[model samples]
Target: MPRIPAVPDAEAGVVGRLVYRLARRRFGSVPEPFAVARHHRKLFWAALVSELGWERAATVLPATVREIAVYRTATVVGCSWCVDFGTMLQRLSGLDVDRLAHIDEYATSPLFSPAERLAIAYADAMTAQPMTVTDDQVAVLEREFGRAGLVELTQMIAVENMRARGNHALGITDQGFDAACAVPQGRSLDGSRTP
Candidate 1:
């Protein structure tokens, strides 16, 4: 259970209920964060809008690179909820989630591509306590991803940091999103199987 209890559907106002219904339709359940955020109406809407905006705006980098960096940040922060949700997202995107087992050895792991390694390393630097991000790291990322892509990468990492830390502090652990909705083998989010 979270340190702060999630608002039950009964107590959720009209807008909250509508949001919860939409969430359930989209994610198979209303995410605990949304339930908890419902307590503060303005902040809840702000967070919702911010999330949607980022989702639409963050299209510069390849999903694989962006997702790996976000997942690495979640692991580094030790946020179980973020890790669980990130895993589900990756799987839905048709990425190989099995390679996540080797994330600890990302620096030397053959599972990750060169671009993934760079992004993962950047995530580590950004998530460090004192923020160990370096000029060389940014320069290399810039050279690889260009200015627009680099910006999107940075924003994704920073956003994940905020989410992971917040969820950790709030005592929000994994809600089993990955296990609850298993995408069938070779199937995509649209229910179409890929070749």
Candidate 2:
């Protein structure tokens, strides 16, 4: 359970109900964060809109590059929920989720492409205490992904940091998204979300 209770359906107002309905349709269940945020209506709506906008607009970077960076950040931050959700997203995208087992060896592992290694390194830098990002690293990324793609990659990584940190602070755990992915199609592992 989270530090605070998730807003129950009985307390969910009209807007909250709509948000829950939409979340159910999109991800097959209401994410715990969304339910928790609904306690503050304005915050809930803002979070919902920001999440939708980012999903719709974050298309400039390759999915592998973006997802790996975000996944790396979540792992570094020790956010179990983000790790679980990221795994499910990567699986759904048809990426090589098996390679994640070697993620800690990304620098020397043959599992990751050069582009992925660069992005993962950048995530480590950005997520480090005091932020270790160097101008040279950004320049190399710009060359590989172009300015637009680099920007998208940075934004996605930063957003995951925010999400992971928030979820960690709130005591939210995996919510079974990874297990959901392992189960047969059209079924959820814990009846929370579908793979």
Candidate 3:
């Protein structure tokens, strides 16, 4: 359970009620983060709008790049929820999710491309405290993907760092978004989001 109780359906406002209905229809259930945010009505609605806005304005990077950077942050922060969700997102995008197990060995693994390795390295730098990002590292990224792309990449890594830490600090563990990919465990999805 979250620190606060969710705003129950019966008492929700017009906008909140509509969003809740839409969430249920689209995602099979309201994601716990949204439900938890609903405890603070304004924040809940703002978050919903923000996420929808992001969806409308497509991410500046490729799906694989964005997802990998997100996955790296989740892996570093020990946020099983992000990791689970990231894996599912990757799989759904038709990326090679099978090689995610080699993430820890990306430094020497041939599974990832040079560009991917650079992004993963950046994720690691940002994930580390007192980030050890070097001038040379930024130079390499600049050479690989000009100034705007570099800025976008850095911002994404920083954002993921915040998200992973926030979700982990809360009691939000893995919602098992990758239920089918890891194994065939017969667990109940009873209390989790269906998306």
Candidate 4:
């Protein structure tokens, strides 16, 4: 259970219902963060808009690189919800989720490419206490992804930090997205059977 109870569907106002519908459509369930955020209408709306805008924005980095960095940030931050959700997203993006088991050895792993290793290292530095990101790290990332792609990567890592920290503080845990999605034709976040 979260430190704050999620606002139930009955209590969710008009805007909440719409947001829930959209979230259910997108992620197979309304994320706990969304359900909890509904307690504060404006905050919920802002979060929804920010998430939607980020999703629709174009990025230059390959999905694997960006997602690996984001996933690393979540794991480093100890946010179970982020890890579960990130794994699901990575799977849906057609990336190999099996390699995640070796994330701790990314620096020496044969599974990760050179560019991916650098991005993962950067994520580690950025996620460290006091943020250890360096000029050289940014320079290398810029070379690999260009200035625009570097910016996108930075923003994504930062956003995951925010989300992971928030979810951690709220005592939010994994919602079984990985397990749920694993079940063939399983129920969605809304508890409706997926075809």
The candidate, 1 or 2, that scores higher on lDDT is 1
- Tens-digit lDDT track for model 2 on 1-195? 999889987799886888788878867778888888888888888988898899899998888989989988887777777888888878978998888867778999999999999999999889887788999999999999999999999999899989988997999877786863221224221112245
Q: Which residue runs does candidate 4 get wrong by more than 4 Å?
A: 180-195
Ordered list by lDDT, greatest first: 1, 2, 4, 3
lDDT of each: 0.85, 0.83, 0.71, 0.82
Candidate 4 per-residue C-alpha lDDT over 96-154 given as tens digits, one digit per residue, 9 for 90 to 100 = 98888778789999999998898899888888877888998888888989999998889
TM-score of 3: 0.81
Total clashes, candidate 3? 0
Task: State each model's C-alpha RMSD to the native.
Answer: 8.5, 7.3, 6.8, 8.2
Query: Best-fitting candidate, measured by lDDT?
Result: 1
Model 3: per-residue lDDT, tens digit, 1-195? 645555677767777778789977765555666766776877776777776764554466676776677787777777666677768768867999988877777888999888888989888887776677999999998898788768778877776677667666776666666864331123222211223
Candidate number achieving the greatest TM-score relative to the actual structure: 1
- Which residue window of length 10 is worst by lDDT in model 3? 183-192
Where model 1 places Cα greater than 4 Å from the true spot, the runs are: 180-195
